[model samples]
Target: MSDGKTIILNRIREALRENPAPRPHASHTSSDQEETPRDHTPREWLPKVGERLDEQIDLFARQSEGLKTEFHRCGTMEDARAILSVLVAEGAWKKIATHTTPDTSALLEKNRAEILKTDTGYQIDDLESCDAGITGCECLVAQTGAILVSAPSAGGRALSVLPPHHIIIARTSQMVPDLTAALELAKERYGNKFPSFLSFITGPSRTGDIERILVLGAHGPKRLTVLLLED
Candidate 1:
């Protein structure tokens, strides 16, 4: 492919060697506010960016392999709590569990759901009894539909990996532009105290490793809901 492209470039250069094209002379043609043709208007590329974001979301959905996804926009703590209630109610997640963490307890109320606080570990047996695993996230990227989880709140990598459903509570402000921005945010937030685990979850866990057939919940949750709390 490289050789073919190089040969094509060489031929084009040779063909244009004698009849050199005239380059446009620089001139102060117009002011910064000059009226331009509507068709030639500087591209409203924000729409294209939006389209790309939609495409990424669709790809994540397809790769999710049937893993359910929902986005909740909460403007206040009350709204966030309400969204949490709805998730718990809709999923019928009666036995909610998580590793003991201040953020876990702060985000969840024991009155709303059964909070079974466990030690920091990811044993399959314990996760088997869990209906949902609610944990805190370090950061999220809007560009790629990815979430970063790290630190003592991670509850071992397996807690986020083994459950049938996982609910991640992240502040809306935590979401950045892309993976690069997320990494920069991590660096600023954690300097040298970076957590032991950092997992970037775009969607739910899925695998097409079997006969080229995609399967969801093969090793992790079949559903992943991210609640972006504004408060």
Candidate 2:
């Protein structure tokens, strides 16, 4: 065998001799004693989150920048509407897809583009053809800069994923510190009848498997924009 291969095999054999493998189902203690459970807390490993709202928002913004998410903090619904209008104009969007929520409906009332409501049902082809998808989120996670969406809160599943651009209209009240808090909020909001679909979207879809070169929109929306309005 090659010198490198022989050296590796010799090291493996030495390690095995020094540690001798234990027999199957070997027990050192009495069978009646129960084993201690492993710790399941995630906060032990996750990044620290601040208690104040402003700190959380700042962290979220920084994380969003790293993820390439377009995040806009609007002082009011009017400001959010203005931003949406600008996006529509810039993208030259002819049609947009959305589910009807009070906030979303009001924001898009004066919008010139044709609106396709996906709440009831919609054709996949029609949804795919839309320039953008607008939906309300279940919550925004500050820790990971993720937008949580469920079938009930957002328009089913396809509305947020099929369109080229995904727009999220959220409120400051919907922001949470981390995934644990977000899950708790969801549990509190929907006790027994949880929605069939729930997802945490961190950023626009991307892949870099082909040539180690990043490519966006490979599997989903090319752009993710968040318009967070003050409550």
Which candidate has the highest TM-score of all? 2
TM-scores, in order shown? 0.63, 0.83
Candidate 2 lDDT over 1-231, as tens digits, reads: 579989999998988887767544524454554442232267655898998999889988999999999999999888888999999999999999999999999889789999999988999899989999999999999999999999988899999999999999999888899999999998999999899999999999999999989888997999999998888
Error of 1 at 151 (Å): 2.6
Backbone clash pairs for candidate 1 read none
Off by over 4 Å in 2: 1-40
Estimate, for each residue in 1-231, the C-alpha lDDT of model 1 and write its tens digit. Answer: 478889999999999989978754435354554544442422332222233634544443343333355666556656666777777788787777777665466668534666666564444676678888877787766655677887555566767766688888767556555566678888898899987788888787778998989776777788888766654
> In model 2, where is the ten-residue run with the lowest total lDDT?
31-40
The C-alpha local distance difference test score for the whole of candidate 1 amounts to 0.67
Alpha-carbon shift of residue 86 in model 1 (angstroms): 3.3
Candidate 1 residue runs with Cα over 4 Å from true position? 1-68, 99-103, 110-112, 119-124
| Model 2 per-residue lDDT at 69 | 97
Strongest candidate by lDDT: 2
The RMSD of every model to the true structure, in order and in angstroms, is 10.5, 10.2
